[model samples]
Target: MTRRDMILAAFVATLWGVNFVVIDWGMSGIPPLLFVAIRFVLVAALVVVVPRPAASWRTIVGVGLFMSLGQFGLLYTSMALGLQPGLAALLLQAQAVFTVVIAAGVLRERPTTAQLVGVVIATAGLGIVAAGRGGDAPVLAVCLALAAALSWAVGNVISRRAGTVSGRGPLGALSLTVWSALVVPVPALALAVVVDGPEAIATGLAAFGWRPLLSTLYTAVLCTVVGYAIFNGLLARNRSAAVVPWVLLAPVVAMISAALLLGQIPTPAEAIGGVILVVGVLVTSVRRRGRSEFSLRVSRSASRSRVSAPVAETARAAD
Candidate 1:
C-alpha cells in the first residue's frame, strides 16, 4: 500500500478505537438492536441527497447486509450481553484474519507470508489481552462478537469487489456506504422488534437521552461516513492484505483511551501485547522494495542476454 493510504487507514482505526469508548459511554439504557437500527436509519438518510454509487443494487444489498446490519447488529448485541468494551474491540479484529483467509479462497487474493505471520502474531496479542484483562464475559456474547467479525470480513470482500468493477471509483466508496445503508434500517428495526420486544423499544425511545443522540451523531458522521468511506477507498486501491492489518492499531488505541479517559488501567501483559500488535502491523505493511529491485535485476539480465551472439562470442574469445 502507498504511504498515504496507510496513514489514512491508521487514522480511521484511531477514530474507530475512540468510537468504542463513545458507544460504551452512550448506550446505557437503550436496547442494543434498537440502537443499531437507529444509527443506520441516520446513515441511510444520506441517500436523499448523496449520489448513488456506480454499483448494482445486489452489491449494495450484500454490503449492507453483512457490513452494516450483520456486523454491528451482532456486535452491539454481544456488548449488551456483557462483553467488555476492550475485549469486544479486540475480538472484532478477528475480521482481519477472516478477511485475509476468505479473500484468498473466494477472491483469489492471496496474502503475503508477512501478512499471515503478522495476523497470527496480532491474534496472539489479542489472547494475551484477554488474559491480562480477565472478565466473566458470557460465552454467547463472545461467540456473537466472533460472528460479527466474520460478517465484517464478508462485507470487506463485497466492498472490495464492488470497487474493482468499472466506474466504481474511490468516490463511489462514499456512495456505496450511503447507498448500502438503505438496506439496513428496516431489517435492523425488525430485528430490534423481535429481539428487544415492543415494550422495551417504546421505553428506550421514551428515555432516549442526549448521550445516545450524540453517540449516534459521532458514529454516523465520523466512524461510518468518514471512517468507512476512507477504508473502502483504501481497500479498493490496495490489496486486502495490505489494508486489513492496520486495523490491529485500533485495539491499542482503544485500550489506551480506556485507561486515560475511563480510568481502566491495563495490566503489563496487555501493554506488551499492544506493542506486539503494532510490530505485526508494521511487518505486514513493509514496502515491496525487494520485489522491485529483483524485477530491475531481471530486466538488466534480459538486456544482457539480448546482445548479439557474434559480439558475445568475439568478446569471450578476446577474454
Candidate 2:
C-alpha cells in the first residue's frame, strides 16, 4: 500500500476502534436500538442532502440490509444486554476469520496454510474470551454478543457477493443506512415496546439530550461514512487479503481507549490473550505471504518446464 493509503487506513482503524467508547456513552442515555435507528436516520438524511451518482435502489438496499440492519441490530442488542464495549470491539474482529471461512466455502477461495493456523489460534483466543464470560458477563449478554458476531459475518459474506455495482460509491452506504432506519427500527422499537414500552421510548426521546445524540452522529458520520468510505475505497483498489490486516490494528486502539477512558484494568489472562491474538494475526498473515511466494515460484517453474519439454523432444528427433 502507498503511504497515503496506509495513513488513511490508520485513521480509519482508530476512528472505528474508538467508536466502541462512543457506543458505550450513548447506551447510557438512549436504548441501544433506538439510538442506532436515530443514527441511521441522520445518516440517510445526510446522504439525501449531499447527492451522489445513480445506483440501483435494490443494490443499495441489499448492502444496507446486511451492513446496517443485520450488523447493528445484533450489535446494539448485545451492548444493551451488558457486553462491554471494549470486548465487543475486540470480538468483532472475529469477522476476519469468519470471512476467511466463508470465502473458502462460498467463494471457493482456498485459504493458505498460514491462514488455517491463524484461524486455529484465533479460535483458541476466542474460547478463552468466551470462558472468561462465564463469571464476568450475563449468560444472555454473551449470547447476544455472539449473535452480533454471527450477524457481522453474514453481512461480510453478503458484501463479498454484492461487489460494488456501478454508481454506488461509498455514499451508497447511506442507502444501506436508510434501509437500516426502515427495517431495523421497527424491530428495535418493538423490542423496546415489549421490554421497555412506549413510555420508555417517549422517555428516552424526551430525556435524550445532545450528548448521546452527538455520539450517535459521530458514529454515523465519522465511523460509518468516512471510515467505511475510506476502507471500502481501498478495498476497491486492492485485494481484500491485502486490505484486511490493517483492521487487526483496530483492537490495539480499542484496548487503549478502554484503558484510558473506561479505566479497564486488564487481568493477566486477558492481557496474555490479547498478545496471543495479535501474534496469531501476524503469524497467519506471514504464513499466507510465504505460501503466495511458493505458489508463484511453482507457477513459473511449471511454465518453464512446459516450454522446455517440446524443445527437448524436437532436439531428440533431430539427433
- Candidate 1: TM-score? 0.89
lDDT of 2 by residue, 1-319 (tens): 4556667777887998898888888768577777777777766665456554344555455556666766777777777878777677767777766667766677565656666676667667655655564377666766666666666665555554454542154555334434333445565567667767777788789867878877888888898767766765555433344445456557657767888999975555555666666666565545233335434555567577775766544433211
Q: How does each model score on lDDT?
A: 0.83, 0.63
Give per-model TM-scores.
Answer: 0.89, 0.78
For each of the candidates, the C-alpha root-mean-square deviation to the true structure, in angstroms, is 7.5, 7.7
Assess the local accuracy of residue 119 in candidate 1 as a C-alpha lDDT between 0 and 100.
86
Residue pairs that clash (backbone atoms under 3 angstroms), model 1? none
- List candidate 1 segments past 4 Å from native: 166-169, 290-319
Candidate 2 residue pairs in clash (backbone atoms < 3 Å): 64-176
